[model samples]
Target: MVVKMNLKHVDELSGGRKRFRRRYPKSLVPVLGEAVFQVAMKAREGGALVSEWESLMKTYDRNVAKAERAAGVAGADDRLSPLELWREARRDAAAMLAAFKDDLTEDERRELLGDELERREADPVLYRAVVEPDAPEPKPTLLDAKNMYLQERLEGGTGRNNKNRLDRVCKRIEATLGPLNKLSLVDLTRDQARTLRDAMLSTRKADGTRLAPASVRRELDMIKAMVSLGIKEFGLQREADNPFIDLPISSKGVAPDVDSSKRDPLPKNVLLAMRDRMREKAQVPALGLIWRLLEGTGCRGAEVVGLRREDVVLDGLYPHINVAWHEDRRVKTKASIRSVPLVGDALVAAREALTLSEGEPMLFPKYARENGPDAASAALMKHLRTVTKNPRHVVYSLRHNMKDWLVLAGTSERVENRIMGHTVGGLGDRVYGGNDAKLKVAYEAMEKAIKGMP
Candidate 1:
């Protein structure tokens, strides 16, 4: 397998300091520092394939620049730096090498360099490091490379939870493979990656049960990503497909499928007790309001927590809350990015929460002040579970109940999904939008359902 160089001066790219990353069949894109002379700015690699020998010019020129500067080989011409002379010499060397040998073996190439080696050998520093070609370029460790990739990755583009997941997989894989910072790029291999998957499969949470299928699958996928990146960054050449590419996600013979039945709907009696109990409490009025919104809208807790005062549309024909994505918080899916009509206790809660949080940006200032959604869920769930005194009946059960409520109310499946921020299975749902009429109907139904309390 032949490794190719796709050299570019760092500045030629749009952003100033995004590390240049290339993948597969070994293309060399430069991660070299800022300089007065940027080579690939003009002579781009993708333009034409001149000759294989040209690949060495960047290395050769860099070596020449180092050697010339050390020996102070300033020419009579002041226009050129020592680096400039190195550049010209590398171009000439590339042409001669192209003419002399089309596909020379290592021995042939070394023989061609015999005289040049002798000339440069006069200076031990230049000859051993360059002209003679045994020394490999400095390689970054697995941790260093992963750090560079993730730092650039997480700072702007990736979702926060995803960024955290990537970090977690690397750490867990490292635990399985041994210390990552000390490990060579070669340590990241198919066998080592298999070890990670095995470890994940055997992994357990506090109760000592084996990891869920979904958890193992996520870890395996992330491991694959890390191993593939390491291979590309290190420029490893192999005959087989990437080790991480096709690992089977196993269920270990049993159905390790996720129990989607976890968030069961609240029974009508239990919900009424919770609503009536929470609503009048002064200890956490915000909690009651938020619970009602979740009940009313069938939206996730995170969506409710991340809601800003500006997003609540009370004046609109159908008062609703926006479940949109924000920089700080992301919804579960694209379908989670719709408005849910605020009805019943939800409308009352939204208005009161708005009044309490008038000066603040977020509707729920406490949860958001700490960090949106997840923190809010934890706080509310603990208290909610204590009061409800039922193991399965928790805060998310409100959302589940909303679905059942809508079905019972005779609302169309389309409007039910729209209100719940779910994908309306049919394409026509999009052709005819989520109109005010549907929202009004859903709101009326939700209002009736929650008012069953007193």
Candidate 2:
């Protein structure tokens, strides 16, 4: 008689449950049991368990169907007699044993099978290793460029405007310095620098206007700086000496009429009135303080945006703000990092507007500090005018206005320069061994200048 057993079905559930059910033909018992046992044995013998399990399922079905057909007939015998069936099963089992005969342990078989299964799931394409290009690698060029840029900024008394000018100059050079298929460094003579200067001058703007002299000068200066930097940074010279030596600067050369005027600093009463108006319109205490702080400290918009909570030292004996780090995490200049005492109206305003979170960056300022935030100081200026009837004001006018106030207050040039962090005009005495107290004193003067008003 055929030993029959119902088929048991197992299902996996997400909530840590295995569902089990039994159904169908009774004769399937031995077949399924044998199939399961064969699969388990294959798994233990370091065989392809999934393939082995599938093959066992097929074998079980064939045997069960043959047995059922035989049992249905009046005088039919089983598909295989008990000994024959045993022999067939033993032969199949022996094939699995032979395949993994060299394997030392059953655990190894299971481990190997698990590894194969994992590898199958995570199948990666096999590729031969390729040789990287022999081209000179991209060394720390960006960081080095940035460091050099900062160094120049600190040394040359450059500002945000100068940084922008250099950026534009480099971009233009990249455009012109291309298609160098034939021009070798050795082929370039000092006269080529003159030729380059002429070519850049002859280049037209999108509007067909000839390039401005200032623009040309800027480009030349950038090239000179690049050559100087190349000697220092990369030793990139065809000759032992640079070819750019003795390049001519025209005798009658006029300074290009680049607009150097910043927004006039708001007068003390106007600034206070503007603050009140901004607060009423923006309806945020922070917004009001934004104008207040700018008017009081004469900070550039970028410097204001770069302010952080930790940098604000309201708890100190002198109570000062460190204006060093930018929102993008770079100091504008070494001079920019020095602490400005929170004296005058700026101190009063900072203390009043101390509602900002300590660790998180200021949201309004983050826009300029980030890669693509709105940086047009004009926008803030426009918004301020919309709220107040004051004649249109430029954002930088605040600094200019403050400078005027400093002069009007009869504050000495040294005191004003220290507060503004303007490079001291004198050559010898200007070299500072440490932080200048004049910076703090300037803040005191600024505070006195503003507070002296109604």
The lDDT values for all models are: 0.60, 0.51
207, model 1: CA deviation in Å?
1.1
- Assess every candidate by TM-score: 0.61, 0.53
CA deviation > 4 Å runs, candidate 2: 1-167, 174-177, 180-187, 199-212, 238-246, 251-277, 283-287, 359-365, 372-378, 381-393, 425-440, 451-454
Q: Which portions of model 1 show Cα errors greater than 4 Å?
A: 1-164, 183-187, 226-242, 280-282, 411-413, 424-454
lDDT of 2 at 351: 70
| Each candidate: RMSD | 14.4, 23.9
Evaluated against the true structure, the overall lDDT of model 2 is 0.51
Ten contiguous residues minimizing lDDT sum, candidate 1: 20-29
> How far out, in Å, is residue 268 in model 2?
8.1
